[model samples]
Target: MRRRNLTLAALAAGGTLAMLPGAAAWSAEGSYPDKPLRLIVGFAPGGGADALTRIIAEGLSKQLGQQVIVENRPGADGVLAAQATSSAKPDGYTLLMGTNTAMVAAPTLRPTPPYDPFKAFTPISSAGQFSMFLVVPASLPAKSVNELLAMVAAKPGAYNSASSNSASELAMLQLLGERKVVNARYKGDMQAMTDLLGGQIHMMFTTGTLAPGFVKEGRIRALATLLPQRSALLPDVPTGGELGLGKLTITPWAGFFGPPGLPQAITDKLSQELQNTLKRPDVHAQLVQQGFEGYGMSPVKFAEFFRAQYEAFGATVRQHNVKFE
Candidate 1:
């Protein structure tokens, strides 16, 4: 299904497992999650995937009697985590926090992608959808996307941008394609963020899940959202279009996904619980604080969204001729 073979190393660091395969396993356990479940995320602790998964994991743990533990497997632009989820037992006990980075951009940017995202996993529910943000060091001379574009253009390779995931990579590809800047790579956004805070890298496009906290700390300032409309979280920040970079608009999303061949019973159960999780007041407030919102849709609806996103990202990939380095 992809140009490259997908191999996800099993980093089983103390988590519960679903019933082992066999027709009798279901009959042996009348209820789902007789044991705890593992929710896999593909980034380090401070990045978008890790942050969002932890929030959802807490809510799911309470809703289900067993704990839904989150495990980090950060690498290869989320291919590592997606591959782990794909190789997991499909009994619904193992799941992935499928983000645009992991599910869409990783595959789009690579030939022989680690896995065919749609084929390797079953869509559970849409977790969260959001616009991207152009984040720059507070010390950067530019305060808007237009100004940054000009700044980089004038200096050429004098400035460098950071990229950890495909969303940021996609943004950098477009920005660099036009203005030509250096891209300093990292295994995770948090790593890149480390440099951004220290002014080692000048700027990046980050998820709403990550940008606000740093911005509030004044370590970095979000110059603009990738969308044409203003963000609910950073109301004062203008959109790229508003800043005269209309070509920069891009909104990436994330969702819940389980290993392929997950039973309908388990899928429905988890989807319902995720919907409930999104509605919790505390969860909602925290998500809002980080610039994320609830996404409620049945597994069927989520599959539709998945297909649409798959098509959209494929177009972007082809248009830009993006590829793994």
Candidate 2:
């Protein structure tokens, strides 16, 4: 009887041991992200992307009841962060704050991209969108698109429009190709803006966040915005859509992504938490203050949106014959 009892006890213990892994998996699913979450930004501190990520991270941390940290790994026009995120483990703890430049534009601009934008990462959600503005020196004669077009056409290669290597410049080049405008290219937006202010470059297509101060101080004049409607911050300026150039809409967008093959349960949890964070009033206000229009969509929806954007930008690149080193 003692021997029989010992055998039964051993069987019971073995059964419980067999179930431990399954039970732990269930527990992880139930409580999800009982650990810290890190969000990687491709730009350095003080930029628009950093500011927006910090605001979102705070709200997300509050929602998840876990510490959410924003890590800046700014380099390669956001490629560094994207590559890091791509190589990271497919765990919910690590996320990349993807920019249009790094995810969509860089693939086309680079001669040989390090990673495939679509294949390397899982799309989480879009944080927001902001329009790019056409800014020129205040002393320039042209006041509108038509006037600028006529001036450029009359002089042919006399006026130049500068832009950074990201989507902003690509969009500007596309619009110019569509309108047949001519000019030069610069290494980055800041350099282009410097030349624009110095009367060396005629104009530039830049984000509202970058151009607002100059526009406010009258150092540069904002001719048109590249969004569907006018911005609340700059109500007086007309959008490219309102000016019969709706195709010129080139809004800068930011979003969250994780390493590829992340578990579905983790992805769902992160998506729900992100949606909740974006809904916060304070988060919305902070994003707006940084010139970002708050927008959040489901992971599937965001994936569709991302693909559409890539195709649209790809078309623009092909039409304009844009190539970068």
Q: Best by lDDT, which number?
A: 2
Candidate 1 local Cα displacement, residue 197, angstroms: 6.5
Candidate 1 backbone overlaps, count: 3
Give all candidate RMSDs, comma-separated: 11.3, 4.1
lDDT of 1 at 23: 39
Score residue 159 of candidate 1 by CA lDDT.
87
Clashing pairs in 2: none
Task: In model 1, state the lDDT of residue 143.
Answer: 74
Per-residue lDDT over 1-325 for candidate 1, one digit per residue giving the tens place of the 0 to 100 score: 3423232212231112343454334443457878989999888898655777788789888888789999999887788988899988899889988788778876766667777877889999988766578899989988767688788889878988888756667666665566777787787677888888999889888767678888888889998787546778778888766656644433567789999988877888889989998888878777776667666679999998888767766766778766667
> What is candidate 2's TM-score against the reference?
0.85
Candidate 2 on 1-325: residue-level lDDT in tens?
9999999999898778658765644555677788899899999998778988999999999999999999999988899999889999997889999988899888866778778888999998888776578888998988898888778777766677776656777767756764555556676567778888899878888776778888888989888887667777678889877788767635678889999987676777788889889999999888778787767788999999888888888887777777765
Where model 2 places Cα greater than 4 Å from the true spot, the runs are: 1-29, 178-188
